[model samples]
Target: MFERLISYLDSVRARDPAPRSRWEILLYPGVLALGLHRVAHWLFEARLYFLARFVNHFSRALTAIDIHPGATIGKNFFIDHGFTVIGETAQIGDNVTIYQCVTLGGSNPTNGKGGKRHPTLMDNVIIGSGAQIIGPIVVGERARVGANAVVTEDVPAGATMIGLKARSTLVPAEDWLREFIPYGTPCDDPPCDEQGSPRRDCIEKLEAEITSMREEMALMKAMLAECAAPPTPVRIRKSAAKE
Candidate 1:
């Protein structure tokens, strides 16, 4: 058990450089919360429902992290900061890291039956701060959920998800090969298009519209010129003096 604790602290240290020592990491709210959660979960599994809830609430009060006792968590799971909520049906796998203010929220069932409503995060997944991964979606292995993303569907393995209603894009091979990415996103000082180029199709469509407008204006000018042309002088045949 002591070795396992050391291993967990080492894992956290590897991810976070701020911690000067394992002792400081031990003082982190996330670490304390996780430790309490183990007891809560154990009580929950033993069918000590009230005791489990009591422990859960106490842990939340102390750490500001809410993890339901019924949630299933695996080895070396790390919550980098507080204000994270894990729903009862959420299942987490090994080496998963979640930043502050993340939610593994559950879905409302119309059938009124309890089931797996929360998300399942596969091993090596990283969730950035303020990300909301709602419903029974599966976040595949090695996937990254960027900060402030709202995800409602299953994410593919090794994909990077960003933006609201989270859009999944495959990371470049070089970036993907890196073991860890801070904030689960690539740093862009100035945000650029994913392909690093302007949108040619939209530019072309605008140019085409401008050309059509110019053609219409030219046609209108020709029509107006014809209409404004002076009527050819009517040649009145000189009436032979009929008087």
Candidate 2:
């Protein structure tokens, strides 16, 4: 346990290197708060409700991050630039990166009890800054939740979800990585025809040509099949008057 603690401390130090000047690297109270919250979260899970609440209150007082003790967070979870709020029932998977101002809260409209109230985030999900993922939805693995996106439904695996209700584009990760723009940009060009023309008339002409070619090919194949078939024997009954 000591070795693991030391190792985690080392990793945190590496990520947040001590600044040359003391004032430059102010040790965020949120870090210690996270540590205590982890312990409190464990206690809550272990059915030590009173103790867990005590620790939770202490941690919140110190860091101002309002994470409910019932929330299930996985390993190596880092919450940067605090003031982040997670609901009581939020389920976060492993290696999920959440930035500042991200909210994973309950969207249950009814004041009714006993139902899933928070979002379920899958593994390796990267949520950009200020993203608001709400409701009882499952965000799939390796999905990128764009900044300030209001996702209300289940996001598919390896998808990039964006927009008001989060419309997903089936763009591969490699293509997304190649782009320099951080946020998504809309295309301005008008739709093109099948034959690479701006005019609809050209598209219609091409479609007609393709349809005609298909019909001609079908007719030719039927003729070839008929020719390849064995010839039927002709009945050679002698002409009635010839005999």
Candidate 3:
């Protein structure tokens, strides 16, 4: 068990450079939350629902991270800087890293029945701060969900998702294969390029659309100007008698 704890701390250190030592990592709210969650989850599985909830509430108060007791988390799961929420049905895989204020949220079931409502994050998934991963979606392995992204659907493996209503961006091969990225966002000098991939950058797409709209607007204005220009005043030449 001590070995496992050390491994977990090492994993967090691998992702976050701020921690000077294992002791510092241990003091992190996320680390504390996960430790308390283990106790809560064990009680939950033992059918001690009240005790599980009590432990969960205590952890939340102490760490400011709320992880439902029933959530299933795999090995080396790390939450950076806490203030994150994991729903009851959320399933997390090994080596998954989630940043602050992220939510593994669920959908509203019209039938009022609960079953696998939250997200399933595959191994090596990185979710940036404030990302909202809603519904019973699967975030595939090695995928990166960028900060503030709103993801309501399944994410493909090795994809990088960003923006509201999260859209996939073309992740460079190097970034895709990289073991860890600070915030699941590439800091490329120029994020988008001419050679668009399966799903190009959302910002690039929006820029193109804006340019197209401007061109269309210009064309429409020109046509309207031509139409609205006063017709050459009818040369009502003075009648021959009135000259």
Candidate 4:
């Protein structure tokens, strides 16, 4: 238990940019909620439902973040700014980072008796602030859900999901965040290339298409000219009708 505490504190210090003493982990609402959640989860698993609920309530009070004890969360998980939510059936994998106002919630609230209701976040996944990952969707490993994005479908691994309905994909080279971010990981498109200029691939493709279209137009003009021209008089050698 002490080792787990140390690890949780270490994660908070390493992941957050807030300058603080090591002992100050005690006051961190996200860290505090995680500490209480450990006990609450144990109690819940032990079938002590009331006690678990009580502990969960206390944790929520301490930190505005509300996580059901029934949710299965792994190690090195960090939640920033609290007020984030994890539903009962939500399963969070190791090293997942969630920002404030994020929700791993159920899309269908009416039927809650059986099966997985919430989203499953895979390892190294990051959820931006205010992003709502609803339903039983699976967010693949290393995927980033952009802030304020409403996601109901499964996200592919290493994908950057952004906007309301655009769902455009950035290149793998641009989407991968190998290092830790001070705050929550960003899910938006990366800046211009290393040279600070826009990528040339799209422009090159457009130019190639324009060239092809010009060639097609030239061929069409040649065909039209041929069709409009006077027919050449056939110099058919007149043979004396049947020698």
Candidate 5:
């Protein structure tokens, strides 16, 4: 398509940093990516695996993107900036947004068996920049993978993953995108406070407090019981009689 060529040219100009003529400013990276991905995707689907790989390699050399031919990427799949990498056998769902330096690679160390090695991402997932999701895991629909997270397990639907090893943040689907999408507006949701909620530190502190309180209450109860007991009476009657 002529539009695709024009878009690619514009992307080249945009990356150049030099001020281009008025004609180049109209180019859009998203549109250009969509167009190129279509051709590359077609070559992939046609079973021209080698050709598809070549196309992706060439594209990456020029654009810094490396989408494997075996990977199934859906429409409106935006790969922002360069240095984006999607691994072979990674199944990407529709309308997914991926940023630069993201990897959807496999972790099959042995490479003994031949099954689905890469991750299977559900629809509407937004992977933040620099995120690394490895293994044959299923990332559920509408889930958001935060930046620099290293996920190796299944992610439930509508969950938000953050941090090293990627724990679930339990964000709502509506807030997930708003919260974790890189370069977007910072989220105003409840902060993951260190001393609040069910975080590890908070849980440990609460447990310690409960243990201390229990010990204190037990000690107080023992003291009160000892004080409340009637004192043993001496032989007062006998002593009075004797007197």
Candidate 6:
């Protein structure tokens, strides 16, 4: 418990630029909320349904972050702000970061009970502020979801999901870890085509353009060689001069 608390503080300090004191971090709403959620989850898993709900209610009243007791969350997790909603069927892996107003909820709002209604986020996933990941989808390891993205499908590992409709592009997870993404995810865009597809599409276009230019250059060189070549010898004029 002591080691985990220290790790939590260290993670927050590393990610957040603000000067932090032990007291401040200890009093942080996110920390309190996570701790409360832990106890609630234990109770829920032990089949203490009513007690688990009561503890969750108490936690939400204090922190304003609603994490369902049935949700399975792993270690070194940080919820950056209040009002974040983690659904009942949501499963979160270790070293995950979630910003304020993020929702991991079911896509079919009309029906509540089913198998795997909420999304499962793998280790090292970062979810930006206000992003909504709905349905039974899996966000792969080290994936970054940009702010306000509406993602319903699976996101690949080590990729960045950007834009309103959410487009995935490959990016190194190491590069993303060094900076404080803080869930305000932004990075250098890989070359993309008109449809926002990756550099693969652009590569074909560039190659076609290069081929056209090379053909034009070859034709110009042939014309130049023809012009530079000497005219056919005038044999009749030479013979007349000799005579």
- The parts of candidate 6 lying over 4 Å away from their true place are 109-113, 172-180, 187-243
As a whole number from 0 to 100, the lDDT of residue 27 in candidate 5 is: 41
- Residue pairs with colliding backbones in model 3 are none
Model 1 error, position 17 (Å): 0.3
Ranking by TM-score: 3, 1, 6, 4, 5, 2
Off by over 4 Å in 4: 109-112, 166-168, 173-177, 181-243
TM-score of each: 0.78, 0.62, 0.79, 0.72, 0.63, 0.73
lDDT scores of the candidates, listed in order: 0.90, 0.70, 0.90, 0.79, 0.70, 0.83
Query: Candidate 6: which pairs clash?
Result: none
72-110: candidate 3 lDDT, tens digit per residue: 999999999979999999999999999999999999999
- Candidate 1 lDDT, tens digit per residue, 8-38? 9999999999999999999999999999999
TM-score of candidate 4 versus the correct structure, residues matched by position: 0.72
Per-residue lDDT of model 5, residues 166-210, tens digit only: 887776556555523442212443643321324546668899999
Better of 5 and 6 by TM-score: 6
Runs of candidate 3 exceeding 4 Å displacement: 172-174, 189-243
4 versus 6: better TM-score goes to: 6
**Model 5 weakest lDDT span, ten residues long:** 179-188
The residue pairs in collision within model 4 are none
lDDT of 5 at 9: 51
- lDDT of model number 2: 0.70
